[model samples]
Target: MASPVSQKLEEKLVCSICLELFRVPVTLPCGHNFCKHCISDHWHKQEQAPAGAEKGYTCPECRRAFERYPELEKNVTLCSVVELARDGEARVSGTERCEVAHGELCPQHGRLLELYCEDERQCICCVCSIRQCQRHRRVLFEEERSKKQALLKESLEKAQEESERIKQAMQELEERTRNIKDSSEGLRSVILSKFTLLRKALEDCQWRTVARMEQEQAAALGHVGENWSLLKDRLDILGQHRERAQRLLACPDHRAFLQEFRLLPSPESPEALLPVEFDVASVVEPIAEILTNVSRLLLEDLPGSVAPKAPEPVGQDHRNLTFNPETANKYLELSKGNRKATHSPGTVCGRQEQGPRFEPWQVLCTQGFGHGHHYWEVKVSSHSVILGVTYHSLPRERQQGHKFNIGLDGGSWGLQVREDCYLAWHRGQAEKIQEPLYKNLGVSLDYGKGLLSFYGLGERTRFIHSFHSVFTEPLYPVFWLCEGRAVMLCQRD
Candidate 1:
């Protein structure tokens, strides 16, 4: 182990910037030594001062000023001394060393800094405190160390809590991703099953059509065979008559020929044959009808049959909705997916002025419901926001502080959330509520019953407020946001 003298020397060689033995120490024009990076950062902060103020550089330790920042040069002597001190103290006894080596001895009185001056928040030696810290509150070195150690322990506990919270969030995210994959696979199976049913229906129709065609073919061939039999019998009788006449003519007697002709029975003339017609078009008419029916059933009936229905619970009327860009304020930016809305920093006018847009820092959803119960949620990112439902005619043009804006007129109703409290607004009326609306809000609108409700959906579902109104026009999901704030429509299955 090194002696106390060697430890004192090592303390003097440390740099104040990093609070350690100096490496490549540099000196300022103010005659103060520091690590090069520390001094550079100090000057950089000075340069960032407000415009039109005095442009001057100040020493980090002494607060001495310079008209212009000087080019820093390496303190060759201090650098060499710090290196030697580090090498010489390689065999130091313990790691419990003083934070500020300069504190080891007072600059003015050359004594140990065994006391802390609470008023100045600095360490001072007994002799120096008597001279400079005469009126300051003071504590012994051990007392101050104990107080700091308790505070450090508390900080460590808080850090551990924060770390555990992060781990829980990560696990939740992984579980949610797995759920999405499972849902997609399930949907795929349903779609394939529906198509398979459709294919089976078509195949059944095909077999029936083929059977009907075969039956018609057999009947047509049977009719042709019957006509052939009748014609063949008539031809055979005529052939026998011709053979009898030839035999009488070969007898060489007119009397014999006349007797044979007279004796032969008279041949009857065959009736004219009727044309057999194949009605191919009539035969395949059923096949054409089968094709049309299959197409109609698949396109019209299958979707409604396989589609999932929404639950009718208070907070379960989940709908996939998007914000309408045409209805957004010029200062508000809607994301490409239309799921999120935030304030834009630009003042340029680009969007067309049309549709049922909210001119007073608000925007409406793309779809509206006129009947049945609908539910949706929004993830809020700001305290100064209003979420609610409104009619499509809720004034697109800006008016002079018109009470007709969202939550302020008969056409709209809203829940306004602030950092500390919440308020329900309708037709220029406001009601104060004690509950805190969280980051994620669930909105359920029962249009038929005129019941509109809001729920805070973080950790647990907490009902905030509800509104009842007479039936009128369709109601749309609307939001009002302050500048530099954002809110997103939550997507759910």
Candidate 2:
């Protein structure tokens, strides 16, 4: 509602002649104001008055006559006033009244708080708006509150979603923790069983060694006992001879002594005894060699064998994937339960119109990986094949000046098999790596660790190249084959 003071001021500023707010207000000699154009047009009409009509100029608002054509002068002060009034009205007329909740009253006016002063961030009444908050921005209290409520709801929803995500992540981590513990326990059991067997074998070897040493010791002691017996017998025989000789000498008969000496012929020299001893070195040398071998084994291999190995840069998730026929180009043929994709030039397969098929000589796999380790192997018929992984965002159109679009941008990576060497391509760049052509190739995608590795699958899986990047989208295995070349997705149960 317009205040009385503003209403009266507006009435004063209005041009009564035109019945609207003055524009370029001008004052005439009759002390009345009107729009300059309105007054001029009125006098121009008077100048063209009919011959019978009164030919004079008069004020349209006051109806007072002027003797001569009064030169119109602009009412500058009144014009300024009218402009101020209209501008103020334009702002004040946007709204009439608003009722605030909670029965709050404006502190300045002691009136109901009908409006919200956005600039002041407070509630106000009409009186206060017209007085202190005339130039301030204001809105209905409910309007501002609704905006705040919307923001609060959005924030709350986001927070709730975040909480749910966090909880899910926590649960996954807990499950992984349990799995780790169980695996550790199982591995411990296996290691313990192996060590126990090894210990038993070692103990058996020790017992056999000790038994051999004991046998050697007994043989040596028997030989020593035999030699001692022989020596003792000879010593007894010599004593008997000595007694016989003494008896002869006591008989005081040289003849008797000579006969006793002849009869008691000189004792035969003691038989030569072979020296015998337990050959400890012979017994221990074999064990020492075994110990030496064991020491070398522990030094050279035990550290690696006794514990789990470090993480492999590549993995063997061994996913069984097939070609996605829907995304295969017309020139490509899928066979063998869609596990093989062959490029047959001039062969057009009937395809749906506007289908999501590649224009290039390329095909995608049915499976895609977003996280964790994933691996797949492929057997190529010949060289000139490109194997890699690509985001779904890869364009289906043929690249300019190229038959295939794989590894042309940030969305894909490729290892192109050439006749001489392999080419690692990404982001419009190619790196030439001279190597043998691997007919059987493997690809490993470690999504969680952001590693994509290509391998040459021979007797041993050989690392060819790898891509390290932060992957945002799930990656699908993609391949491009040259004419007359085919690729088969190796299946592992």
Q: TM-scores, in order shown?
A: 0.36, 0.37
Candidate 2 lDDT over 72-95, as tens digits, reads 876757765775666533432212
Question: Which is the leading candidate under lDDT?
Answer: 2
Expressed as tens digits, the lDDT of each residue in 1-493 for candidate 1 is 9899998888877777678676557888778888776778777877988999876788867988988778887675675476456553243223323323544655665443567888888888555566788899888767888988999999999999999999999999999999999999999999899889977976886787678767877777777877787799889989998888678768887787778778988789886664666666476554543543444354335566432222333445578899888888888888889999997656533778775555677888988888888888888886888889887878776667652277766678899988888988886878898896599888887777556778887666777776766446788888888777899887765
Clashes of 1: 1
All models: lDDT? 0.74, 0.79
Cα error, residue 167 of model 2, in Å, equals 74
**RMSD values, in order shown:** 32.3, 30.7
For residue 234, model 2's alpha carbon misses the true position, in angstroms, by: 99
